[model samples]
Target chain A: MAVSNPFVLSTPSLLYALDLAGTFVFALSGGMAAVKHRLDLFGVLVLSFAAANTGGITRDLLIGAVPPGAVSDWHYLGVSVLAGLLTFRFPSRIREDWSPVLLFDAAGLALFAVTGAGKALAHGLNPVMATLLGMLTGIGGGMARDVLLSRVPAVLRADLYAVAALAGAAVVVGASALQLPAVPSALAGAGLCFGLRVLAMKHGWQLPVAAPADPPPGKD
Target chain B: MAVSNPFVLSTPSLLYALDLAGTFVFALSGGMAAVKHRLDLFGVLVLSFAAANTGGITRDLLIGAVPPGAVSDWHYLGVSVLAGLLTFRFPSRIREDWSPVLLFDAAGLALFAVTGAGKALAHGLNPVMATLLGMLTGIGGGMARDVLLSRVPAVLRADLYAVAALAGAAVVVGASALQLPAVPSALAGAGLCFGLRVLAMKHGWQLPVAAPADPPPGKD
Candidate 1:
């Protein structure tokens, strides 16, 4: 008996291309972070893979998809390795301006959010859960990279990072509810996410941080 | 037709007890870390759950188990929350002595390693992969906790943390190969792991750190 996997079925060529692009950009960010931290070559590669694939791998796992595409597919590995090598060889060129990396990271984040929600919906997950999963897929890679480097994940405290992903995912979920076409819905979701992230960066927008706490009660 | 899930079939009462013990102890450690970092109540609870269940959840996901026990079953959450509450209420009591926490942590590590390998084998994974999965399960929770707090995972650099788990898992695999009884094999594996961890702590043993790197070549 043949079991049907949604990943094997619904991955159109355009979506696949966008997935690879997202992987490449995320891997580049990981490689840049590794170089900034003065990690060795192997560490750079490891971070690249982790940052590029962790989110998707996590989403796959939650949905009962074993042997996640990042693990089983060679293209993901190849893209991650190529990006890592490029950043390692030309750190100064990439590091000269942080804006480009940030822009690409936003693009990667948007792509992941859209794809993740679509995948979750395909797997029969409810809209609320699918949106959350999509946001998770956007943030999970960067969180893993930061954790491996012993730093707090920027998504946990950054300006509208997760919020942007959630908004994008919600858009996709809403479009599906409205019986819209998948391709145009994805494009619109990605565009909204990318726009929100860039605008937040330009305007120095931020989430509210917790206020300092008063001293704890003595023996109460 | 009823499909047999390995998790539903093979979870003996004793193993279930051990799993809960591991979760509680790990959760305590997480709560202690949160208290030390001055995290709020909700933060403590989140860290506790993340540290207690990440290893098991990851293991189940890899083995094609959806809705991991950590998420599906209520016992794990209840135990984690109980431990977190206790630690939060009596922070000084638990934090005053580090040795107790270390000892419990070792016990939890051993339990997780043994169980992880057994579950992998039950799912028909090869011995080598099962052993490695066991080590990952043993270390994954602590790694998650440390990462959330922005610290390097102790397993990656500490004295024989992963090594002890691997050794324990290897013993389990070896015993199975020799057709030894499952109970004895589990006991032996857990004992070996616990003993090694304690000894390493007592002797202040450490893994070797990478040496400082030389200056990079100019535009090579």
Candidate 2:
């Protein structure tokens, strides 16, 4: 009997890279927002971790992933910590620009949303449920981050963030029907989501605000 | 035929009292915390709704109770809003000492825990999962509340809060098994939970602090 080569590590390595980059950008967004609010260093770090981890945590728990995703992984913690430190060191540079932050935030949302839907599908969730999970993964963390900062969630605001996530999930599900390769299809879906989100921000795309009398609930 | 339903109104009124008081007190706890944190009036109101409604929201959503518990009932919102306004008018006096806040918080936990357990059982969940849902309900709102305030969650700390919620849920389960009256059993559970929490806070009862060592993995 012969052992297989170590080349198989590439798949996990690629996934890990995507996960880390996604976590880092979201954490950076959180840290920068905290700086804008003039929160202390400790507050910035807390916000960063909360924003980077909360969505994945909620998704994992709801989907019955034991111990939850963040608690089960240290890579996420490291990524968030690095981002927090960098944001603190360069607060002025990071906080000055709004468009770039929105772009990076959109990228994080896309990657995480696809990752979430893919994870759920791995666990045998239906397409509808997987889509919901994807939306949650894209928005839950930023919502938690915003509530902690005493602001309305960006997802609830006029943005294409959730729309992009939804579109990505649609791509994955649609691709599955066509018997496309799952791995490459997943990447393409994620890329489409990222591109759409960035383009939306660039073009000032926004969801129509809800009627003021029907203010969205569920913060508590 | 004259429409006369005094018993329908009177008996339901009693059960309504339990939920109403619980909502108001929890709203007060949330509002006072917001004031202490120096949040604006809108902030206090937002926290009040979040803290007062989150446990019920979690319970309803998990049990597939559509429209959510609080959303279906205007009384819950009414009480929370009134409590927020009152706290705003008297922030200094309302949160003068931490005792009342802790007590009200404990009481709120007990109420939601029992409510969640009953709901799960009604929805035909197995006993163990019902207990778990009850626990989630009790702590979920406070977790949301604290996260919004940018603090490490109190439920994750050394206090007996989670324990109290467990006791309340257990009491409900035990009472159901013994065929005790629902109202009386609920009060007993609430009393037990509140007592345990008040005692723990007063005596500074805590889980033993673990000695620091090499931090986990990259934490060092």
Clashing residue pairs for model 2: A148-B148, A220-B50
lDDT of candidates 1 onward, in order: 0.81, 0.72
Q: Write the per-residue lDDT of candidate 1 for residues B124-182, one digit (tens) a residue.
A: 77889989998888899999888798776768867878888998988877777676777
Instruction: Give the residue spans of candidate 1 off by over 4 A.
Output: A1-11, A214-220, B1-49, B67-143, B152-220
Which candidate wins on TM-score? 1
Report the lDDT tens digits of candidate 2 across residue range B101-212.
7778878877777776666556555555566567767777777788788765666444667777778888866776676667777778777877887888888776432222
lDDT (tens digit, per residue) of candidate 2 on A1-220: 1112122122455556666788899998888776665555555665787788788878876776644555435667778879988887776565356777877788888778777766666666777887788778878889887777666676886668888989887776566556566667668878989998888877889888646886567745
Q: Per-prediction DockQ scores?
A: 0.16, 0.04
